[model samples]
Target: MKNRNLIIIMISLLTIISCENSYAEIRWEKNLATAIKKAKSKNLPIMIDIYTDWCSWCKELDKNTYSNEEVIETAKKMVSVKLNPENSEEGEEIARKYGVQGYPTILFINADGFVLENVGGYVEGEKFVPYMKNAIDKLGKINVILSSKEPSLEKLDLYMESGNETEATKIFNDLLGKKSIPDEAMPKYLLGFGLIRAQQSDYDGANSYFDRIIKEYPKSEEVYMAHYYKAVGMILSGDTDKPKKYLENLIKNSNIPNNIKTQYQTLLSYINED
Candidate 1:
């Protein structure tokens, strides 16, 4: 009886290991030509996962982000392809064309082979799902925006203010692509503000924009506000450590205004009360 039980356990362990290995080993294409050909044949959009072998975050994205259920389901609608930037000339060319300066860039290309968007870095399931959905939805609006004779910020702002978040996001992304908008203090600040207001209920959206603000405009006054808003959004989203970390950063930053410091302290106290 003991020998039989041990054999059963070993079989179970082997099965589990096989499944795990299968999931870990993804079908990576060497070049974009194959992906494009497949996309044309299948009449599907292409999703290219650009990475290098040495990138730890790239591995995490493969293991966690792309393995996510929603990501996998959404990817099924498209021609999924993985390319190593260092290994393939075609992949390198695509990365250069799309302005991918970093590893783990995910490019969503239209059926016609035009690069729609280039999203970089590792993102978990919750954040990744919304980004994919937004990217898919934005393609149509991008056509409209690009075809328009006068593509103005007003139109973009209207879309943003009118609750057409997907369209607004696309317009902003398009603007960024064309280099029409400056990445100066003012533009980043405005974009961050708009994202915060537009996605008040969307903790992930708010967090994303606030994070950009912190990264891009660390010296700007908006950083303090962004930190506060990020903390609030994180707390609401059940990210326990983020709120505390943001608060602590704000508290330590001597450049923060007295009123903002007071507010941060008050919020911190409130959070710690229970």
Candidate 2:
């Protein structure tokens, strides 16, 4: 058994080394503007590394994370750019625009200039690979949404469906700034905002939005979902009793879909089991 274990470990090490040797390098662009232009022309997404000369973690990222075979392979699908915030005025301006306060900030931007994801701080190769994959997945979905002639609010819904909260938040905030939003759209808008806040782990903020949807738009189609999410937020906030009662009430009195009612029942069973 000992000999077999040793052999297995050796084989794994050899495979890792082979993968490392196969990828040459990620061809990194020096200028952000040029990288963006190439990405737009080629219909590719952009990956920007915001680094500084004096940042040790930045060098470590180049040495460790960037050298990972998976990261190199994934980076090939996008236009990669490296910008030093202290190197030029343009770099400084762009860094400020993106709110890049930390060193070695990685930004994945779609071809149309919307940031798909922002990864802050130093991350290991194993963890960093997933962030790149998520950004790429979001980029594809956002591009499709952008090309469609969907109405602006519907586009926001599409973004939420695609799990592109960064873009959705931008549109949501912009719409909120408007003097008046049609009553027909307000329930959906509030629900979307609540979902975003929930994703951010701000249960209080999320519940506030859900409350608005339930109270202000009681007759709207989104009210039932608002009730569901509010219960979820309460559950996540470490209080299961209130949500349990709320779901019980919903299950008894609400005319929600059978499938949704089943989901609520399952949640209640799981909560009871816990």
Candidate 3:
């Protein structure tokens, strides 16, 4: 009878452990298409967790970050999708579209099917929660832009042209910081323009903003403009020597738009003449 009781107790303990593991909620999806479809149907934002199977950091994010109560709760409000970059075509497409060159890329896509943000690599729960919140806030802003009857781009341009540099800078900076804006050429152009205006007479301030655009938005259409402006700012501030190297780099960079390159070259000629 005692042996029977021991066997029964062991069986009950095993059952309880199995149940606990099984009940542990792992919010994951296999494919982008399916995830998108579900998000669209349910009117939820899409959160893509880009990972590689062999990545230890990726596993840690899954085990610790994703399992954190705050992260899990916040994540439940959106459609969660997992993509293994090494295995799936859908995953590869998302990775390529967002310029995700490395593992553990977290993408937050707004309801209208536009990518709001692309966060790369791993962070712990404390840091991760704020990141997610910021992404969510950006998603909210996108919704506001979409709901407005007036065109957002036009309003943005008006703000820029009217010399409301502070407001324009705020909007763009907010968008960039929040990851609420799309990875479009036009917005980046406007952002670079706004930053230039804000630092018009302040070379140090201007250089900092220009450098940020260069470092963070390398593929932006405004890259040449950023380079040119950086050189101009440096030159105007009597930091002429530093400008020469960047000007040379701009001239050498084959990817720069032709018209912009010509503009920079013209400016360089003027600087040399004086």
Candidate 4:
């Protein structure tokens, strides 16, 4: 009986090792610099898996999502790196830079160091592939834009779409300085950046962006949305009085649609109750 039990234990250990090897098919680079260098050399993007030791979902992502054959195959087209924010100062700084709020946050960045996509939370393998494919498509578009000699504003739309705010702002400032930006595009550019700032929880910065649209392009259709988001940001930032006052003024604006007015009125009522 003892010998039989020992044989069963050996088989279980072997089975576990086999499963582990299956998960190890995709090589994960530990050093960000090395991964970036590899991606640059190969003209590929970098896929960063930002995880923590204590995160159970992160482990599930590794065992279930990353181990999927489809995911392993897709990852071959890019450099995959794992980062533990709690492990090293470099990891912590990188996580902070990318605005990582939760574990298993996947970042897809192009060779030019611009972010292509930021995927937060855990997703299954099938859902995860689309994000990777989208990032890859964006990288291709960025490369095409770089290889062209088109006007700067033509590329501005792509930059904003990819969440490359730094480049988008540079182009925006240049166009604004030269008075070359189209009137219709200004509100959109401002609104995009404002939404991005809001997503990052930088309510003050978001309000500033939204304010630009309200002040500069008051007659534009986007002005209503800009005002709405600005008020929402004020509320999010804990300025109860300002949001109420702002929403009241917005509700009074004649240009606002009846539906939007109702929406704003509802929000205002909620705040008043609060």
Candidate 5:
């Protein structure tokens, strides 16, 4: 069993080394620490391919998934690392830290060692390209937020969806201190502040933040959605009149999407009929 494990580790390492010479050209680091260094210096996210030698799916990733031209091309954009937890103490330790619950888990992480995404199972070129691009896009967006250069509604929405209050607090605090917060980030900032408050059941506070977005960033699309959520909060607080009037005004706006319009329209219908 011991020898077989060693053989597996060797095969995986050689496979990674072979990639450097391949036409597709993926430079995969065998040691994660080395990969982390490269990621930081190069300003690239780390893509860790977690697999075991015995797993058929792991082998399939090599022959099918990783072999794709598109996959190889995308891999070039990252600090690539491949490890089989059985290889060394460093490998096992890294595996546990990342919570590798199963075989063939692909971890997307930043240079700061913050985990971005954990993609399980296998993905083909068509699906894989976008899957990878999505993570990279998110990494760029997150960097902008982290750098306080730009803020993204998508990032805020993601943090809210995942219940990541800690990061949200950090982002909120970061934005609060900046003397000149860009107009691009302001709408997301207001909407995110409102969303965070709403998640905590602070309806009045949430509405205040949402109202700020409407009053200050009136031209932003966030205002339309903000009105919808604020109206929902009003209904929850048993104040039908105010929320209903707000919704009535929301539905009249042609700039908002059909869904946002329908959301307000549906809520008002329910409130009036009740």
Candidate 6:
């Protein structure tokens, strides 16, 4: 019985090892610098898997998401890297530089060494390819814009659609000085960034951005959104008086869209207590 059980255990161990090898066979570079160098030499983007020892989601992402054949195949086309930021000094520095607040941050880095996007959270295998591929595509789109002689809002629009804010901002500043894009295109992006800041609880930062749009792009449809977000930020920042006055002013402004005014009108009403 002991001999039989030993033989079964050996077979199971071999089977598990073989299964693991077959699934996730990414050529993972541990060092970020080495990966960046390799990617730069090949004109390829880098895919960084930022993980930590304590994150169960990170382990699951490795076993389930990276194990997908499509994901593995897609990852092969780029300079793939895996790093445990908790365990390595280099990894921690890289992760911190990219705003990695959570484990399993799938960072897409351009060949120029810019972290275009640091997407967090864990996704399943089937959904992984498109997410990473979109990251790679953002780098390509940004590169095309940088390579062009003049800035193009149309091309920048493509980058925005990919949701790579880091790449978009760099391209915006590099190709066009401040406020180069058409007023219509410019305010929306600004407001989008403002919303991001607001979500991060940077109320002052968010309000500043919103105020810029309200002042510079009064005719823009985004101004209404800017006003709403600014009010929310102000209220969150504990300014009970200022945001109320701002919302009331927004209501009085004929430029604000009627629908937008109506949407947040209740919040404005609530602020009138004092």
TM-score: which candidate is best? 4
Worst 10 residues of 2 by lDDT: 149-158
lDDT for each of the candidates? 0.71, 0.81, 0.71, 0.85, 0.77, 0.78
TM-score of each: 0.44, 0.53, 0.54, 0.77, 0.49, 0.64
**Lowest-sum lDDT 10-residue window in model 5:** 148-157
Residue-pair clashes per candidate: 0, 0, 0, 0, 0, 0
State model 5's lDDT.
0.77
Off by over 4 Å in 3: 1-23, 154-225, 228-274
Full-model lDDT, candidate 4: 0.85
- Report the C-alpha lDDT of model 3 over 84-178, residue by residue, as the tens digit: 76788888876765557777888888544566556788988767877667767766666666566543554455455434556666766665676
lDDT of 3 at 102: 79
lDDT of 6 by residue, 15-124 (tens): 99999886567778868889988998887889888888899999998889887888888887789888888888878877655556888888887766555556789989
Off by over 4 Å in 2: 1-23, 157-274
Tens-place lDDT digits, model 4, residues 1-274: 9999999999999999999886667788879888988999999889988989999999999888988888888898889999898987757977876778898899999866678888999998778999998888888877988787644786887677656688888888887888888888889989999987887789889989888998999888888899888888888888899889889888888878899899899889989998
lDDT per residue, candidate 2, 125-178, as tens digits? 868988888888887877777886533665777666544667777776766677
Off by over 4 Å in 5: 1-21, 149-274
What stretches of model 1 exceed 4 Å from their correct place?
1-30, 140-274
Candidate 1 lDDT trough over 10 residues, lowest sum: 185-194
lDDT tens digits, residues 1-274, model 5? 9999999999999999877557565668978899999989988888888888898888888888887878889888888888888877766776776556787888888876566777888876557777677768778876776674454444545554444567766655665677445676778767877876776678998999898998998889888878888988998888989988888877787777888788778889999998
